[model samples]
Target: MESITEEQLIQMVRDFIESESSAPQISVSSSESHIDSDHHHQPSNIDTLEEMIWRETTDVEVEILEKILMYMRNMGSLIIEPKNLKKWVVLRLKMDGYEASLCKTTWVSFPGRAKGNYEFVDVITNGTRVIIDMEFRSQFELARPTQSYTKLIEALPSFFIGTEEKLGNVVTLLCSAAKESLKESGLHIPPWRKATYMLPKWFSENCKKVSFSPNSNSTIEEF
Candidate 1:
């Protein structure tokens, strides 16, 4: 299969979100008084998206995932495992007494195209099934100093860094980690749509410097 371009990747994800959002919700009829004995909780939209995307595969997906894995290994302690066909644990970032589970999902296949199977990333936290929207693509800007941490910080409730000062520090650390990871992975992000962005207006005055080195500071535990 041909490699999927980054724009195609982003477009695929956007399309998937739009399609799922537009889908009509199924309602149960009152005539059916009893639910099935084996009925289970319905999966979230993200779960459905993941399942749908995982059905297709491509060389681009492999290349993208490999880059992410290389970058993750340099960041901190990680635990990698396979969950199943539609889902699996690629990396569990363990640091600051918290864990962020990163997985591959959202394989992009156009409505009628079969060769373009691009994948996207999702992060989950410990003891929870909710997918934290990092808004990575929304935050991507090639000209800025990557600021991909708002959703991540909000999602990581277990982490102690919450104050404006500490939060900015953590954000900076994350941005740096992302930069290093992408660099090491040799991923070519366009100049106009780089994975990083300038600090938001609010962060301009609140950012505080903190000592954080993914390679030197954090311990590594691979599984």
Candidate 2:
């Protein structure tokens, strides 16, 4: 079996997404899809071949893929592997027309009864203070992740919305302002991709300029 290169994998995804059919059939290398020997679990029922390709993959993984493509056309690739029965995907970003692995992004699931399971910083990009918080649960979720982020904003004076207008609660302040915290933060990100994509991209691009750093209380998970 010829080893599949990172470039080939990236082109596969691009081709899959661009295909005219709603669902396209693409062959994946067994090594790429192979699970660990210790792993013992039934594969979840998949509605599409795309989902089967990344069976253990999550919606978040697809989001990260889309964001990487945003910066470059066919230069990025993703490799999905299992870690302790959980699927982890490593992103290879395009550098000088080639793909290079950054680091393995982990997936942390929580018990439903556990408090604050869904609310925390998911992962941080290597060699940068670009923190991607795993909040964005509905504005009505019981956890209220946005409220948690308010502490980050209050702790650092340098943090501000990505738009030109001043920031505040939309209900009480500047309802008519052209710019808004939610809009600027990409909260209303199109249904086509992850809501958190724009935020990370913004932080990655402005980490140095804004001097953005989360406080000690911020729940940052490092793998």
Candidate 3:
């Protein structure tokens, strides 16, 4: 398979932005056919989410996304476990002169939430911080989805590289949509899927930052 070039990945982002701006038409009949009448009466949350995700890309975000795309394309030959991939990506970014780290966040069980931990990569460029999730799209997928919810999922990028503010907005939109989709299907929404729980996965104050030195074989520091 031919590897996707950085230019190609950047073009894909541009195309996605343009497509979102134009609001591509989605086919609803097939997926909505089995939905309940109450679902049909609900407001269009997916449409609102689609509009929310479409915004002008910052220079920093584009640069980071492009670099991540290149790194991912080159990683195809390596074992692609999430832990190793995240560490590798962080190392690569650091070698390229960017401040990158692996962030692990853990929280205890609290009211309306459960105890859990999550890990992801983040980079700081020119004093701006951006969250990078290699498995972004998969996080929002549902077993059974209404047509509108499916459309919203389709619009999400496979990987997410953006600021905390943008990520917060995305979590809010997707979680709300997910709740509505589950309600429509007569299923319970998993606690982890809720925005309140999901947001802390990245935004927690208790997060530990781990950094790797580019010149060392096993030099890792945590703070």
Candidate 1 Cα errors over 4 Å, as ranges: 1-3, 32-126, 129-223
- Sort by TM-score, best first: 3, 1, 2
What is the per-residue lDDT of model 2 for residues 19-78, given as tens digits with 9 covering 90 to 100? 313433445688757776888544322223223323323454445546544533432353
Top lDDT prediction, candidate number: 3
**What's each prediction's TM-score?**
0.22, 0.19, 0.74
At residue 27, give the lDDT of candidate 1.
Answer: 55
- The better-scoring model by TM-score among 1 and 2 is 1
Indicate whether candidate 1 or candidate 2 has the larger lDDT. 1
Question: What is the Cα-based lDDT of residue 182 in candidate 2?
Answer: 44
Clashing residue pair totals per candidate (backbone < 3 A): 3, 0, 0
Ranking by lDDT: 3, 1, 2
> Positional deviation of 193 in candidate 1, in angstroms?
40
* Best candidate (score: TM-score): 3
lDDT of 3 by residue, 1-223 (tens): 3544445544555554455557645445876757686665443665555545545457898788677657645543344333466787788899889999999999888988888888999898888898888677788899899887898788786667788878888899889889998999889888887988888888888899999888986532220
TM-score of model 3 (CA atoms):
0.74
Candidate 1 whole-model C-alpha lDDT, 0 to 1: 0.33
Q: Mark the regions of model 3 whose C-alpha exceeds 4 Å error after superposition.
A: 1-54, 72-82, 218-223
CA-lDDT, candidates in order: 0.33, 0.29, 0.75
**Model 1 per-residue lDDT tens digits across residues 29-148:** 775556667875564433333333332323334333334334434433333322211122222222332233333222222333222111222222343222222233344222323233
